[model samples]
Target: MKTIKPILFFLLFFFTISCVNQKQKDQEEIKQTVKNYFNAVKANDLEKCKLLIEDSENYLGVIQGEFNFLHKNYDEINPNDVLLRNILVKDTLITFTNEKEKYVQYIIKNDKNPNNLKKPLIITFMFYKPVGYDKIFNRVILENHIGWDK
Candidate 1:
C-alpha cells in the first residue's frame, strides 16, 4: 500500500507539471500572435494581419474598418515602436464557450494621427478546445475608437 501511494503521488505530480507546461506554452503562442498582429499593423500589411488572426467572415468588416482609416488620416502604430513592452496583456479565467477555457486581452496605444494624437485599441483573443480533443483554436477581437479608458 505504501508503494502504491508513492506511485500514485508521482503520477499526479507528473500530470500537474504537464498541464502547467501546456498552459504556459499556450500563453506564449497567444502572446506571439498578439505581437505578430502589431507588427503587421505597423507594416501596413493587412493580408498578413488577417493570416495572423482567425480567418472568419464576421471579422472582415472590423478588420477593414480598423485599417480603412489608415489611408484616410489615422495610423495604427505609435510615433515610436509599440513592442510587446508597450502592450499590456490580461488573461481571463472565465470561459466564453467550453472546457473551463479563457481569453487573452491586450491593451495597446495607437499611433499619432494626422492631428498628432495617440489613441488606444483593445485586442482580445478567445480560444476553444474541442470536446475530447487536445487542440484549441483561437478567435481574435479588436475594438477601437470608442474612448477606451486605458
Candidate 2:
C-alpha cells in the first residue's frame, strides 16, 4: 500500500507538469502565429496572411475589405508599428457553434499612423483554437479609433 501510494502520487505529479508544459508551449505557438501574421501584414503579403488563417474563405472578404481600406486611407500601414500593449488568453464558448475554444486577444496601441490623426487607434486581433485543434485561427480584427483609455 505504501509503495502504491508513492507511485500514484508520482504519476499525478508527472501528469500535472506535462499539462502545464503543454499549455505554455501552446501559448508560445499562438503568440508566434500572431507575430507572423502581423509580419505578413507589414510586408503586405496577403498570401502569407491567408495561409495563417483558418476558414479563410469565410473571413477572406472581411480581411480584404480591411486591407483595401487601410491601403486607401493610410500611405503605408505597418502592423509592426503598432506597439504591443497587452495579450490576454481566455477560454470561451462559441455560442453559435457550441464549441469550447481558447481565445488570444492582442490589444495593440496604434501610434504609427502616417496620416497623423489625433485620436488613438486601438487595434485588437483575436485568434481562437477550437478544442482538439492544434492550430490557432484568426477570428476577428477590431479597430477602435476612440481608444481604450476610457
Candidate 3:
C-alpha cells in the first residue's frame, strides 16, 4: 500500500501540471485570435479578419460607425469601411478564482467618406463567460453608448 500511495501522488501532480499547461495554451490561442481579428481590421484586410470570428446569418454586432452587419458576406467585410481607431482589453475574474479570465474590447470608429477625415467615433465591448454548464469564453456586450462629446 505504501508504494501505491507514492505512485498515486506522483500521478496526481503530473495530471495537475498538464491541465494547467493546457489552459495556458488555450488562453494564448484566444489572445492570438483576438490580435488577428483586430490587425485585419487595422490593415484593411477584411478577408483575414473573418477567419477568427464565428459565422452566423444573424451574427450581428455593431462595429461602431452607424452601421451594423457591415457586409452580408464575411468575405466582403471592408476594413476601410470599419475603422478600428483604438482597442482596449481588460481582464476580469469569472470563476475558478484566478484560473479564468475575461477580455473586453473598446474600439473607436472612423467612416469611409473620403472627404470627411475628422475625429473617429468610440465604442466599447465587454466580454464575459456566459452562465450555465458550458465552459467557454464569449463576449456579452454589457454596454454600448455614443461618446459624450456630442
How well does each candidate superpose onto the true structure, as a TM-score?
A: 0.62, 0.66, 0.48
lDDT of 1: 0.55
* 114-142: candidate 3 lDDT, tens digit per residue: 44444543333323333211221332221
**lDDT per residue (tens digit) for residues 12-61 in model 2:** 99999999998887767666666676656666777777677677778888
Winner of 1 and 2 under TM-score: 2
Model 2 root-mean-square deviation: 5.4
Writing each residue's lDDT as its tens digit, candidate 1 over 64-108 gives 666554323223334344445554334445455434554556556
Which of the two candidates, 1 or 3, achieves a greater TM-score against the reference?
1
Clashing pairs in 3: none
TM-score between model 2 and native: 0.66
Which candidate comes out best when scored by lDDT? 2
Q: Rate the local accuracy (lDDT) of all candidates.
A: 0.55, 0.58, 0.43
Question: Candidate 2, 84: how far from true, in Å?
Answer: 5.2
Q: Model 3 Cα displacement at 144 (Å)?
A: 3.7
| Backbone clash pairs in model 2 (N, Cα, C under 3 Å; residues 3+ apart or in different chains), count | 0
